[model samples]
Target: MNTSLSLLADLLKTAQKEGADRADILFIQTQSVSYQIRNGKMEETESSEQNEIGLRVFLGKKSAIISTTELKPDEFPRLASQALAMAKVLPEDKFSDLLEASSPQRLSKNLELFDPTLPTNDNILAYITEMEEQALAQKGITNSNGSSAAYGKSHIILLTSNGFKGEYQHSSFSAGISVVAGQGPTMQRDYATHTTTFYRDLDTAKSLGLQAAQRALARLNPKKPRTANLPIVFDPRIAGSLLGHFASAIKGNAIARGTSFLKQALGRTIFPKEVTIMDDPTCKKGLRSRPFDAEGVKAAPLTLVEEGTLQHWLLDIRSANQLNLPTNGRASRSPSSPPTPTHTNLYFKNGSHSRTDLMADIKEGIYITEMMGSAINGLTGDYSRGASGFMIRNGQLAEPVAEFTIAGNLNDMFANIGLANDLEFRYGVNSPTLRVHSMTVAGA
Candidate 1:
């Protein structure tokens, strides 16, 4: 065991003996490595470190939390006193509960979160530089793109008064390239991706660069758009964004505060029957996988929406207490801010339609490739957004298009949206190629 961990555990035990009905302590340690290449040269390479801990105490109906970077015995009592004082002044909260429940039984394994033999910044830069050189080889590519790669590792532990103690560690890495093609009025740009929990999962630099160049060249001929209520096909990347939209709708905090559209829609069919949404924090190799969440609550897979029917809303300790339900282990805390809600590896299940097959069904609809601007009301479910992509002609991808607005009420979009079998788990929230019918398309 790490020496610091033992000392912290002792500190927590001491806090429990100091007249508090319930208490919890969290310890966080993190490190990051980042490399940036500019103009075919290594521009930046750096690392960061973070070490902090937080403590929460409960007294009767009131509760408060305090955190510090200092890890001394004299500071603990002062921090506790400050929290107790603050708890005395705040109004009684309905969601404040001292949880004494046991955790779910889960198959546990030690996940490998560190690779000491991973390439260093200099070696990684050499690879990125080589990639840019390859991208510039494309005939129409006017300017080669630089690449940025980052790796991060975080370790966290949680100890609660009710006999729950847990810890988890994880790692993440991402690489991206931006390419410019053509010249003057024909100038256009495109990008490509490579990201994973392990270094081995990334694509080679040459492949990544070529993909970026090919994507940019595909947008050569711009097409004009028109105002029509037609089916819009969302590529896998854009489709995944719907998960965030759903996350907002089912946040217990949002519902309790009367700020969520789904607040009054529990047990109702919120999305199509084929659209099943899950919050999985233990997905193998998932970037957000963990045994626990930011607040140290045990993490388990949750079905937020299943088979079109509303199921569960995300909950933190506070919100769960108020609802008299188990916490979902989804909360975040910063040095200056209190605990708040977040998601981990929220995924939408795949259907039975591929991207090519799905697009072939759209005769004259828009294929949204990129989304811009935010125009969704979290509380009302009203949605409108600026989009850029391509237009479909005769069931085939036709001319490139840009600067269009797609407007629809999310409450309606949910019920009418169709899922494609092209589901991909690229980033955090992943969905497949999605088709939404009869959205108001504003184009000239």
Candidate 2:
């Protein structure tokens, strides 16, 4: 058994012995390896490993959480006693509940997660080299910001007093390029990347580099968009960003705590009938798919919003306890914490209109190729972001533009947004070209 697993079992046993009513133990370990290439040469290659264990114990309705990276045998008992002592002094709560349904039901796991002794560092570097060379070959391209690849093999274990115990290992990779394009007195730079759990699914380094090159080159002749309140088209990447805002409103934790901007708006026509959003943790070969969440509960497909009505909120053990709902396995943890409500593979369902047809009648509008800055407010759903892209004049991409701002409120945006058929799930979250009827487009 893994050291972390053994530590979790020992920690839980000791916690129970120390007079806790109930408790759960969470163990985590991660191995991260990375390779970076700069200016056509390998800049750095490195790896790191770490491990930790967290204990959550309940004394009456009060619970306390404690963690440690040290695995010494004596530390377990001391940590348990210390946690109980703290819990005893804390106030009781209505939402406090010990882990239950800790045992997971048998189900299919994400097969794409991990494999031992993956292709050596040499294999990854070779591919990165190819991508860099491809970008340098592009005309008007001079030097590069860099090309890089990263991989992580992470393992986690969960154990609870209610007889639930499970562990899983996840493998992931990220690759991309940053290129600089130059013309006589002008230079522009940009980057693009793809992250996946499987190595084979990544785009060729050359393809990745070329795309970055194209992005940089497109800015060479950016022109101002014709000022107007016309409809706009958002590529899938940008569309997905807008959809992400919806997740915050659907989070049960957020809604119950009165922190969400979407509170009390349930049961009403919140969005257009064509707009539907769902989260599927079991998406086959999906980058964000997982067999089980950070909490040891059953996970299945869930529609956050169906058509125009709110469906359900994202929940974890903590939030579920407050709402008196069943465990939805929506929990996830980083290297330093325990399970919390997080998404699996959340995305908007693709629509049926093609990009050309979607933009057919629009005489003049902007096609936002990229958005800059984090200007969306989670509480109010209001959004304002710096942007740069191309102008659609008479239904054709006429000129590139930059140094502008786009602003809108999410409520109004979703109620009137239109989705094109071109939506593709390039990531776990995706949407087609979306057209927000009218937004304030601040010009250069």
- TM-score of candidate 1 to 2 decimals: 0.93
Question: What lDDT would candidate 1 get against the real structure?
Answer: 0.77
True-structure RMSD, every candidate: 2.3, 2.1
Most accurate candidate by TM-score: 2
TM-scores for all candidates: the values are 0.93, 0.94
User: What are the runs in model 1 whose C-alpha is more than 4 Å off?
Assistant: 101-107, 110-117, 334-337
lDDT for each residue of candidate 2 in 102-161, tens digit (9 for 90 to 100): 234786664566756476878888878888888889998887888999888878787888
lDDT score, candidate 2, position 1: 49
Best by lDDT: 2
Count of residue pairs whose backbone atoms collide, per candidate = 1, 5
Error of 2 at 341 (Å): 2.0
Question: What lDDT tens digits, residue by residue, belong to model 1 across residues 1-444?
Answer: 277677677667666666567777778788888887866877788889988877777787777777877678767667777777777787776566544556644634544544444577677887788777777789898885567778887777777777667776777777778888898887778888877878888788888888888888877766659988988888887887777898887777887788887888888998888888888877777877777665666668888888999888788877777666777788766643556677888877887777777778677998888889999988788889998888887678888898789998888888888887766677888888888877999988
